[model samples]
Target: MTITRRDFLNGTALTIAAGLAPTSVLRAAEAQGPAYPPALTGLRGNHPGTFTLAHSLAREGAKYPGVLARESYDLVVVGGGIGGLAAAWFYQQRFGGNARILILDNHDDFGGHAKRNEFTVRGRTLVTYGGSAEMPPSANDNAAVRALLAGLDLAPRIQARPGDDYARRGLGRAVFFDAEHFGRDQWLAGDPFAALVDARNAGVRPAPEDLGAFLNAAPLPPADRQALQRLAQGETDYLSGMAGEARARYAQSTRYAVFLREKAGLGLPGLRFLRSRSQDAYALDADGITVAQAISIGLPAGAGMAAPAIDPRLGKSPASRLWFPDGNATLARALASKLVPGVAAAQGQEIVGARFDYSKLDREGNPVRIRLNSTAIAIEPDVRITRVTYGWQGNLQRVEAAHVVVAGYDMMVPFILPSLPVPAKAALRACVKAPLVYTKVALDNWRAFDALKTWRIHAPTMAYSDLWLESAPGGKDDPVVLHMLYVPTVPDSGMSARERFRAGRAFLLGTPFEVLERDIRAQLDRMLAAGGFKSARDIQGITVNRWAHGYSYMPSGLAPDDANLQVALEQAGRGVGNIRIAGADTAGSPSVTAAIEQSMRAVGSLNPKT
Candidate 1:
């Protein structure tokens, strides 16, 4: 089971033509843990069930034989997130009318975490307020976003903002806390030497203060340095870096894990934090270090018979440099308005284009269809899916898709994709820092708020999450809105529907009344303050944008190595011939950029007619 890069390449070449040649090397991989690259293996699984459902639904067909008749479509999209929407958009934009795409979301609307805020103000009949916000400044560089802009003819509108390594590579949130309270900026702007002296005097040792302190403490073996460089030269040559079984693990891993197993290659002071139970969530913040120190950390550690070939940093690292526009939601609102006018229709009476049933809406007015109502039920093989099936309200509905585009952790995918046949890259399944949830608060002082407006800022909380959306053109009086995320309760894992609803309500009704509210208010208070309007009655209305669960979990050190994994993930991207996946799970880590990239990739390759 000691797989070398040579063996993988041989297997890859052989597997590529399994439809034409015998993949002996591919067989060796199959015998182990990795899910056989479908393009290489012909083993399809599923013991035919009683076929009861088919028969039962067929009974309806007998009564009305043509009732649930299957309809042929150029594409049958299984999931409807930004990725799917982008795919549909790209397909039409690239190959137009010929590809009759049918996007199916168990939910009513699209845009995964891109759900929004709805507000109402008294003495003001118009709702000139609402918008989507809180995104990585790197989105401007996102291939998918660029493709989308090109598709929509707004590429020029995307102002060219230079980005930090982290921003361009699309990793890490530009995490900012109340600098005045946390002294973050004082620490950031103050000389690194001065801050280092302060922390050192305060007895904060072993904590990374400067490049030298970090290097001095890192556990890199001098002998391994040469080999580590070799790995960085080419993933194909990286295995030579690890001593023993470590080299073998790289050959069999699901691309991401090898990074966990191989980072020992860095012969400097690089540390890994165990953020989750999975073996893969280890991270290395190698900024301010030499290029060599950064590259040394990219090799895979042996995980049984698996190893992924990865170069520590593929694009760039997250540094002090970053980028953002007037507000990050510019594209989200611009596109959401174009795609789901139903979102605008739900904005009271001002916007009048598409109409949606308000009663069928979530408390936030986001249509019911887009919400993931149930806890993850099952993930199966063949198509490797997370299946959340329901018979609630006397309706049979299911959210079935190949990959979950899990931006949180690998374990999340397993929780939903119970039957996932791929190597349970447990290391890759772990989540990073708790995702920050955002929402906006509005104060109505008996004034007519603009019902439709542009983006706004909460200035106090440094919460740029608030914005004004124009559901319908020419409507004035946008409502007062507060866009925010910074939820104190976004636990490591996901929550059930019951948990989501209660948590959401606590954020709304409990504010100024709830305990967490006091803590948050203290922070926002530092940024903004208004006391005259006291009671909730004095307040006409409020809107919140809650990503109880935010997009995929992305941290440092999550680039794939083995080419085979890329192949497995790539194959998983396609859907029912025309149907395909569009999210962070494919392409690379969880980010709007990757989501857009994968969507465009799938869109270009789609033969919806098939």
Candidate 2:
């Protein structure tokens, strides 16, 4: 018999009550009192609240095909993206031939937004479009992600460079920071602890510090100033070190940023600043908790942290985390490679993945087998799926004993279930997610102006949101620059700052060319005139892709912001069954961790781990 959500949790509770386990984690949880989840509440800042949480994190393009027939198997993975691929790959590795897996997707390829656009820009070849922009990471805390990299054997190939290195190459050493608000290097390089010590030693003093007096001074609201002052002094570690808001912020920030930037961005330089210094799911969503939760669960598992500014980077904040090469893209690619051979090699425009093999099974008594381009229509009795009538595609498909592991955008959840029972529908529907938008940009310039080595996130001069993306990551002589942006979308008429992004069309782009050709020409007039290529005319080809819901949101909420979402996933089989979920959106942690988590979650549906 299939285990329901209630059954699963109750079983867990019983298992704990039996005291057969060897760990005291539960007792510790109880003794520590009510703890904060640190995934969301840990990081409190203004953000775009557009993403919804009712489903998994993956996109089922608008042209999704309708289920044309009925067929059953060990698994029926609706989406063929990274999350699903990860689950399938891991299952294959751990269980081998023990489990049969079948992956179904509406798109022509398997990688989803990870598609690449290669073309000659100013006569240079580039991995132009779609997918990650950079490897936004800090240090050690990325165990699961690194483990995946180790499995790939591509860990050493990772290229690590500083943000400024990219900027200097592009700007001719003219890299600039805000003139006011914060000091030139204080925001990125200052150490608050060191400064404090120096200031206290009778006659000694630390020079070249502006954020100090300004941030700590009574210039703005008390709360803002308090955090700002701590940040200015580099005492942020105190928050997390002693089980305070800072630690919670650090965990939440690291988790959210690593997930979005490293795992999701995967070599992408998007998301100018993460909300907290956190590095896990708790950073994304605080769930419902109080000051006590903020202290206990939010902080690290050790002695209280030292004073701020003492090698702040080394103080255990989340932003200072390290990363692996290829980020999570390598993992996605590896997973995709396992599911579909041709799919792995063809992640770009030239048509990846194997050609459509089998047809959908349109009638009963048909042998279950693999089929391509088959859309899910609905699920009846919360178990049986019924394919919808579409433009006569062909015979129904069924893969005997095929198992599925889906990991993609959560919004596709509704469609994943071919049909749904009224009760399960309400529960799944209640797991609402915040709205989100993922946008990326790639540009090739005729002339090679410096500043490629240094990375920066300064907003455009005007009319748009402030520059929220990290600096570009290329050397001045790199010949091309790629930039990605994380723009949040607000709904209807709202007074929120995100209203600006909502005004524009949503695009999950990885284009090969920047539309601001005129701007490029102007910036490189001298270089273009000297380098042979004059204007946009000399530029070559370009490609781009867009997703309305590229990434999911990590709003502040109950324990582990995604707790409710996790609960919602239990009803995967109750929908129309047409929605196929995947992506970081559906992830409980919303990072590589969550991506990994949801994939396993999907697997438990088809084949229990134990």
Candidate 3:
């Protein structure tokens, strides 16, 4: 039976007042203080009241008559995401600091998917990322990305923290077998899947001896256990008879699951165990990933056959990547600070800890204003100026700009700009986003994790596939934040990647907060019960950052590359008169660097002679 919110609250020893709504819990705490977006826990990311107008315009064909144009700007950027923010910065740089620019976003907070979640437990403030978490080495390689980082006084590279804390505490990676799939609750101490990826990193190494014991302890049938043991041992070359080029071709064309079943000899149980391994990177299961793609990402294929090396362009070392306490939200905050002077008052890493003054974001006389909770409904381009109409407050507001940058979702662009060509609209509609959830649970203490002797747990069949502590607790009583990931992909469903993404998106938006909360609590309680973890007593706060339209979809390697689709994506990003498109989706890459690069390209396209 589905657990209700009342049942959950009644069962737990929650510190918050009874009957207080989850959405208002944080707001009530900040009644006497300045409103802070990061600290407002529960139902964030694509929060309610943020998407109503957009949904109405897209789904119901609702029209908003343009009100009298109340404001004019040199540039009006739709969507206050990284792309839009970067576009504003680039425009100001190109047109001088005096250029009047405005950025409009539907969400109450800026940064879009680059969201920051903050919590206060036991009088201590903790920071965690709700979305857009890492700056990989490839991001720094882009000159535009590097320039943006340099302007913010931020370093592209961060020194990896010395030593593995989990190892030091006698804890390691683990796998939790849920009753739904395994028929019983079982926790295995060592995870072979994680070790496969971790082995590629130079910073830490897993002991080879643990693999045998871990695999044997798994609740798999004897045949499945034997198959997994063979794959882990990496002694047999599944593609032994083929030449190098033929092997490469086969790997690219064949699915990873197909390879395991046909060549590696894995049965149903083994296939299920390995399904969600690829979800963290591609948001797809083993059935969706190509054998070549799987090997390149450090998934075990056949160690006997020279495994295809990780793409050098993507960067192989984990240490080369940089991250802030609140993920790439640091980059967003840095951009906002540069664009709007008083949004944040710190520099360098201090920016991560700085509390943003939301009031200063859209001041009367500011050259660059970021107006949040303003949803753009229409964008009509004229010979000179473009008329932009947005739903704000209780009425439709109009604004005119010399040039408009369409930096929001490519899919929504077709709805907003109905004047676009049929082909362009089709291309825009094709950019389906992968649906996922990044949940942050503020805990009273992480003694349970220490007791379990596992900092990370991978549960293939559970609601959340992956869960890990943001960092090791300093003491048994120290409060901590646990991060969880859920990707709603229907693998082996005979649907195309885009179709699966759309299905996942629908499922995410349809599921309520209470259901998500219940699943999280139940999963945690089941996984950590042996460690003396009780969700009611330990979980202090939960911020469910549901990205129904999450990661910008890219080809998942299950299907052959389509040239027509590539051309369509390119055409989608092309400028139409005074309107220029810029976003990760438009750029055809789901990275901060690509978004910034697209923004720069879009800005450069505007008024070239100037």
How does each model score on lDDT?
Answer: 0.33, 0.33, 0.77
- Residue 29 of model 3, lDDT score: 23
Write one digit per residue (lDDT tens) for candidate 3, span 1-610. Answer: 2212333333233222234442232222221222678898878888766666666656645555557899999999999988999999889888889999999988888998999999999889988888887765667578788778877788754534322666787877789987767878888877866775667443234454566677778888888887877786666788887888898778777888899999999887788898888777667778777887777676777755544455432311232354676778888999999999877878666898887899898899999999887878889888888999986655667999998999989899988998888988887887787778899999999888888788888998776888888764486588888889898766555556776666676566667899889989988988899999999999999999998777776654455544365577667677688788889887556677778888998998887422
Q: Give me the runs in candidate 1 sitting further than 4 Å from their true place.
A: 1-72, 105-109, 122-143, 155-394, 397-420, 424-434, 444-483, 487-540, 555-579, 587-590, 606-609
Candidate 1 lDDT over residue span 406-483, tens digit each? 222223343444344455333233322222334345544312122111122211123232222222212232344333
Lowest-scoring 10 consecutive residues by lDDT in candidate 1? 38-47
Better candidate by lDDT, 2 or 3: 3
For 1-610, candidate 2 gives per-residue lDDT tens digits of 1112333334323211232121221121121101211111110111111121111112212222233344445455555555666656556556664355565544333444444333444565443224432333331244544554455443433344334444344432111122222222222222232233334322333342554453343223445444434433333333333356665555433333233333223111112221211212121121112222222222221124322221111111222222322233444455544444433234322222222221221123322222223333332222333232211132223332333334544434445443455544444443333322222223454133232222333221111112122233343333443332333322112222122112222221111124323333443332224334444543343222334333334333323434464455545432333223444554333344555545654454443422
Ranking by lDDT: 3, 2, 1
User: Best candidate per lDDT, number?
Assistant: 3
Quote each prediction's TM-score. Answer: 0.43, 0.52, 0.90
Superposed on all Cα atoms, the candidates' RMSDs to the truth, in angstroms, are 17.7, 16.1, 6.4
